[model samples]
Target: MLRHQMTIVSETLMPADTAPSAAAVRSRVTVPLRFPDGYTATAEVLTFHGLADGKEHLLLALGAWEQALLDPEKLDPALPDAGPLVRLHSECLTGDVFGSQRCDCGPQLREAVEKISATGGFLLYLRQEGRGIGLYSKLDAYALQDTGLDTYEANVALGHGEDERDYTAAAQMLGALGATTVRLLTNNPDKAAQLTALGIGVTEQVPTEVHLSPANHAYLAAKRDHTAHTLDLAQPAVPSHDEMLARVDALIPRLRERAEETERIRRIPESTMEDLREAGVFRVLSPKAVGGFGMGVETYVEVVRRLGRGCPSTAWTVGHLIEHVWMLARWPRKVQDEVFADGAEPLAAATGAPVGQATKVPGGYSISGRWTFASGVMHSEWVLLAVQHGDVRLQCLVPISDVELLDVWHTAGLRGTGSNDVRAEELFVPAYRTLDWALLGAADNPGSRIHPDPIIHTPMATLLNLVAPAAALGAAEHAVEMFRERVLVRRVKNTLEDRQADSPLAQARFSHAYGLVATARLQWEEAIRVVTASYQRRPMTMTDHERAAYRLSLGLSGTASAEAVRVIMAGSGGSAHRLSNPLQRIQRDVDVLLNHPTLTLDPILEQAGRGLLGLGITVPSF
Candidate 1:
């Protein structure tokens, strides 16, 4: 059972000029506090004015019993007169109200409230958002933190102190609340010392439990190391996939820097490739038994999306190479052993078009043809060539030594992919090196029997086709970001408006484009989730309708991305057409990407319509 009663005794609004002093009492209200955890207490909510920022603030004095109106002249006889628990919690709208995982503020606040409810104490909810920098500036600091700055550093970058909060208002509130001596609930010793200096006796300091989480682990660590907060920094939690994404995100700057060089040379720069390899970009989709991460398809796509945000070309190449590892796992055990023998990732490039001729032999097939648009061939050790042996289509794995590279990729966009032609002249691939296209499509491959991982049994066509649109989504998102930055400061050359950001048209365009991009991303993610979920189920199977719908959703995502880029380019003005402008390049890349056979919107929609109508699928593989 809980017992509490709350009522407002008075309400008043003071003018800025007539605001009460920091120690001046304004009004008092009784607040019946009840937590979800069933802890209940009655608190006298005192309002004060003329704080550090000259704003009204609040202090809640809670007790196990009801207290009289707050007065500085006398202490509540029912409340403890000596030591009492105190919490000086700053206000955090994001963490407290909205439950943002970016910080431990909400959890700390709740913990403080719960403790104060169980034991008699005060919880001074300071009106300091973002460490006394205010709400908007705090949000600005968050943007800086996203760019690889620690919380304190971000505040410093925004021209604020590491600790901008002053304890004067809190001390005054405590004095008025009749808290002469206190047992502070805080991790910072400075808080206790400051309160003690302000004439309050800190008899004891109770350390708050560290609310450790992936989002705020680094933040907590920063407080422990730099701010001298008492936190055990040792034995940090294991990194999650989100942390892996953060690691990839940290490499975006380098990838962006090398984008032009990659395009100029029609290949990913050696340094950039090495960095990506070291980052485990190529091993994301590989089997764990063979020293691979064996991440789910959704996570793999997300990684590719992040990489694409930095450089779509690099993202495309990396996605293919990583996905090829998954495909290789569908081959025979002998082939898997040979491919992963050294435990080093063998970068592989693949082409799905069965343009090559394969002559059936006793042990294998003799393949001869030129495969066009083979991305990442420049750096790959092996090439998965799609060849036709009689009436059956086969994916034959051949070493780079068996193929001749032709520098034939000349494109307006994605030029960095180095998707050139590879010619194989009578290259004899052993039986173990080839996988039947039908078996792979049905998720019934030789490798699935040996390696019991359900992901190995995923439908290959849908998995491979999904990567291109993921890269396109990244590029589209980048275009939106570029446009947002440009429009904020850019102005109409002769117009009265000072900035494009102030223009209604610019605002509408940005909003529409952002909506399109966000919707596209959601569509892509949901599609990947469905596929990965199916893979997790043993003996994964996809109906014709399911397969067609997946392809259709991917195509829609690609088209949506292209539409978003188009909208941004249209609103960006003439400067966006320049070669140096990334918008134009992104636009071109999306255009070329949408033209991909699997990602083509019209055909995919038609196939989906056919599948839904119970007709034959135009593209049976997908």
Candidate 2:
């Protein structure tokens, strides 16, 4: 049974003679938190002052967490204090703050808050989005999860390991919380080791288990297996791939329709986009330098996978837009100061296809040409028009006012993307505002010269390539949701057979699709994790490029999404083929996503295969 009381399992332990050191870290680095719709929050690091080599370090008064932010020592002045309840809860903007049903993190956080409030404990909520992988990868994972891989396996399939989180900073925060000993509220054992290694005493473990919803039971299992969490489960019997495909084949038509509806509306009416936004979807690519929530590339991949489960367009737009912001964030402070002189609402777009030109002027260059396939153009305050200048390709940021948007994004899929063409007539862009395209792709971007890190300058190609996979995964996830709703009441064809939901075949397909999403998500996250780690340590290297390639391989889950669509749609039969069927629309969306230049099968294969073979890859392929 789960206990609600504060039961002490061990005596308090504080390292004696370990006084707080005089070394001060300027914790007041200002991080500008950017929100969707362009709202900004100034995050001032209230604390970073600390001492001691691990054991009993202190960083008092961090972010204003639920008005729950308070100095731990102030709560209890007793010498060396009994310590606050140091909770290293991962950032789950949607569930914890907004209460989404997709996962248990939100509920668990609420429970922890209630417990901590009543019992006087400290909660250190790290800004680690999507388990430190990032939003894009998480969304991709969601798509894989829809395909039936367990959570751990899904991350792996997506090129990630089981878990990618660091607790050292969390430990520092704990010390700042005036916590010498803590009863951690967690199921993962790794948290315990991390804290202990950091020289903090984890006296007891407070188990915070969430009841599994039908939608997330497999997810829980994956966490237990892959992340080494303390959750227990009995593996179900494995079924053949043929049976799995047959099951999903039946539901495609309805899924296709639902996907189309989501895109046509520009917003998912059934689900709240606000919820996703709060989940840190829009901040995945934020740079650590600014006040934006910084997430590694691979983790972002997983974030997008999860969002994809709810709405593809939201995932796509958020993922693509954030990556663009990340690129801008790397610009020299002077450059950022100049461009952002008007504020951060500059609308920017990219046409992956090389097709524009610029002439060098005295102080800058005049750019003119028409570029298509620019996502988020409808809402951009700045535009990144790629143009050929002399011998090099450059990405010039032109004010939205200087560019004209052409509504040319008429298609049968991803309709809500609002991707249109941007036409400019000899617009003068300052030299500093222009990023050499070749340099940008070579991981030698001008922003990198300013920020000087591989993570910042890695080619836009590597990052942008993930958009289609996430979109496809999202389309497939809609199919799963639709199937779940209809399976119980709908009956399978044949001579008086069981309800479709009751069929073993249905269960198998649903479960399998779940795994695929999970696997894809894992792979995507792993890729970002590798990149982020490298960023935090030394600058990025060829290893980072390999990680990017791995991300591409996992993002190829569009293929799996397509397969899932085919199976689910076929299972629904001819009635689903009608244009009115949601499944048909999902199919069309998947088809469109597959054909997207980024998700183009041949290129992805070539890039990934070349990397695996240890061959040199082109500048932007990663």
Candidate 3:
């Protein structure tokens, strides 16, 4: 169906036909509105200037669908749309207004236009250059970019906040446009909270993810690490915790039994996947308006952690399902109706590593090529795949019917995950199924439209870490249980005249390891508490966000596991290294998880250091 159907005639630029009122301005600007059936009204440009930072700043405004969609420019309650599609965009003088390629401002702006143009949306373009620190400072940082400084460092060396953008002007602009609520499109969380503080309820966050390039790869990491942008290049699309656990509870025994079969076939049995469907695990994260559970992140995280107790692969798979659903939740209702009207589950898996292209077409784009490491393909009814569209990389969701799953999930660990290759030839994905890669990570992600919690707005990749720690914590707990029991009855050969538990060394090791695991558990709980606290508050501060990200990186990422391992190994003794021991598996799994890009020690240390010392930390090589 077509969206907004208003003609933006050039004459709309005429003044409001009234004398200057203290509260109103005779602004002149051209705007474009889209209609259903893929038709668009003639485009017109309107010049609207408003007070920003006590100075008049010019704004080129475009008006789209005003019914049922939140228009950020409108503030009157009576004229408000049923729901607002809010987008908080930072002013990019170099790219947005001027088409510069040094960054993704132009591409993001174009993508935002097309998306909002499709539906009724309010794009609040705040005049904060270079992520809020003006353009001159950005350029100055660029000049010093090669001298052992990341994007954040370069900005700091130039004497500027890592990010200095504010949103008061955006709120005022929304009020004037009769937009009361919004579905924000951004990766920056601070922007979302700021708009909410102004009484403009941000219903969702539309993500705008950008393509990775040699020029901006490191720059992107700075956004994720220092600025708290939420792109997870490692696992492009995955499920949330709630979805994963529900699937696991229903599929546990089946999966456990199927493990032997999985080993033989090197893939999860199709029947096991079917078992998950009957369980409703896949739909919990769907948009509530669409009849899905619409559970919050806290519930979802707990569910995944509980499942992690039995199997890490299962927990991981469940997380992937929920995150993918989180992405699907951001689609317009019309789109949502088409995808989930049947109330059937949509199983999706993604490979974070990008490799392929999606060529734009009339109604949508024709996506093709092979993508590897798709973990849940054996079970998925749909797949959200990452593809490159020219220099711009995008995420496209496709029905499983459109693609073929290749059996190639052989690995030393997580062997039963069935993470194989996904091959598709010219799969037609409607426009609604596609999302801009960079924008999705931005602070004001559109998915927050239905799920308003900022925790839901947290980066998709950062959420993936929850699974690793959940599994590690579970395994660690299990190992502790085993060690305690073994030492109670098992006698040390010639070295000790009594059971292992009677030895002072054994007692000391147990005490220490138990303390470490307990501490790690507390850390995980503390992190979850912090995140949940922000959810109740709705709008979090920059300091709160920084602390939350740090908690994830420092505590849950690897620090917790590192401490747990020391205790576990010390208490278990040399015999724990045997292949038959679960201790060996727990240690190996934790070790492998530590190598994850987000959880590694170097970046975590850097981030903690910067948070403590007022500096910036860049993502390090894993």
List residue ranges in candidate 1 displaced over 4 A: 1-239
The number of the candidate with the highest TM-score is 1
TM agreement with the true structure for every prediction:
0.61, 0.54, 0.53
lDDT of 2 by residue, 159-236 (tens): 886677777666555544335466677887999988887667777777776545434666776777666777754322
Stretches > 4 Å off in candidate 2: 1-262, 265-280, 341-347, 442-444, 449-461, 502-537, 543-552, 574-582, 618-622
Tell me how far candidate 1 lies from the true structure as C-alpha RMSD in angstroms.
Answer: 16.9
Ranking by lDDT: 1, 3, 2
The candidate 1 region of ten consecutive residues with least summed lDDT is 1-10
Query: For residues 446-541, could you state the per-residue lDDT of candidate 3 as single tens digits?
Result: 666646534446555445556666666665665677778988987887675479889888888888778877877777777667555654553432
Candidate structures ordered by TM-score, highest first: 1, 2, 3
State which candidate has the highest lDDT. Answer: 1
Q: lDDT by residue for model 1 over 1-622, one digit each (tens)?
A: 0111111111121122322233546777998876544667677788865455566678887764222223311343444444577899989999988767788898898788778766667889988889889899989988998898999999999999988887878876765555556778999988988877666777778898887644676788789988899987443232358876887898899988888788889889998886876577776767767756666776788888998899999888888888887888878878888987645367788986547999988899999998898988988888999999789898899998889999989999999999999998888898878888888656778877877666777777657787789999999988888888988999788777899989888899999999999989988976786687677766677677777677777888998999999999899889899887778878887888989886887778888888878897866566
Off by over 4 Å in 3: 1-280, 425-427, 439-462, 538-557, 562-581, 617-622
